[model samples]
Target: MTSEKLDRRKKYTRMVLKDSLLKLLKQKTFSSITVKEICELADINRSTFYAHYQDPFQLLETIEDEIIADMRKYLHTYNLQEKEDALRMTEKLIQYFSAKHEELQILLNKSGELSFERKVRHVAEQFMMNKMTSEEKNTHLPEYVSKFIISGSIEVLKIGYLRDVRNHQKKWRS
Candidate 1:
């Protein structure tokens, strides 16, 4: 096959594997998922699965890393200093999750391996730390303020996106 066709085929195969893993994650924890199961669900052999990823955790990490990278690009591409920046960021998040709703919902469902949720929390914390006033070193106002607002905003986005996905699924079912 041509190089273009081969690359397309590889991409398609990776999507299938990731989708299969996501589907499995919805039913059970990441730790419970096996390479065999993923391969079976993906309709590929163990070797094929191994070729792309060493194990389930590796696959999950790969997917989460890609998602987190995309998220950072989306959220940090513009500075969030004003109220409208928050609004724009929220809308962008909604759009991002909506486009990959099902896949995101599953991978983000409390993966037992690595906590992307905690990663997001750390990111928010770092952003808050950067925004802290240098003169108010003793106040710690940034920590307090960001803990309440940014963390809450992240939670709201997660809950809202998941709820919207569930509602969409329901709409499709009925």
Candidate 2:
């Protein structure tokens, strides 16, 4: 096949694999998923799956990246400098999680199998970096201080989600 056709095929295969993986995720945790199961679900060969991902975890990473990109789009107003602006961003985040509560639950459950906390922390750090001055960005906050701020916010939202699952209580939390 021509390179162009090969690229198209690869894209199609990746799309198929992604769709199948998402379907499986609704019923099972990420750790229980296997390459063979995904290939069977996608009706593709194991080699094709390997061509796109080294393992199922790589596919999970891709899924998380897509979700984060979508969240970033939804949170285009995220600016940590202005408290009001951050409140709006927090509302948007709460909305996003409420809409995807099932998926987020799977990712945030206490099974210690979840990686979304790290992903959320990374997102928070990125938001901070984007809002800070060059000097502040260069001066790294101590790790504990960093976690104390970001992780504390995330944990509040994480638990608060179980309550109303919408309407972020930024005033109370912040």
Please name the candidate that would achieve the greatest TM-score relative to the true structure. 1
After aligning candidate 2 to the native by TM-score, how far in Å is the CA of 38 from where it should be?
Answer: 0.9
True lDDT of residue 137, candidate 1? 46
- Please report, in order, the local distance difference test score of every candidate based on alpha carbons: 0.66, 0.66
Question: For residues 60-140, what per-residue lDDT tens digits would candidate 2 score against the true structure?
Answer: 778778777766665565553354444444455556566766555555553565566677777755554455455755666
Please give the range of 10 consecutive residues that has the lowest summed lDDT in model 2: 80-89
Write down the RMSD of all candidates, one decimal each: 6.6, 5.9
Cα deviation of 174, candidate 1, in Å: 31
Candidate 1 yields a Cα-based lDDT of 0.66
How high is the lDDT of residue 128 in model 1? Answer: 43
Q: After best superposition, candidate 1 residue 172: deviation in angstroms?
A: 26
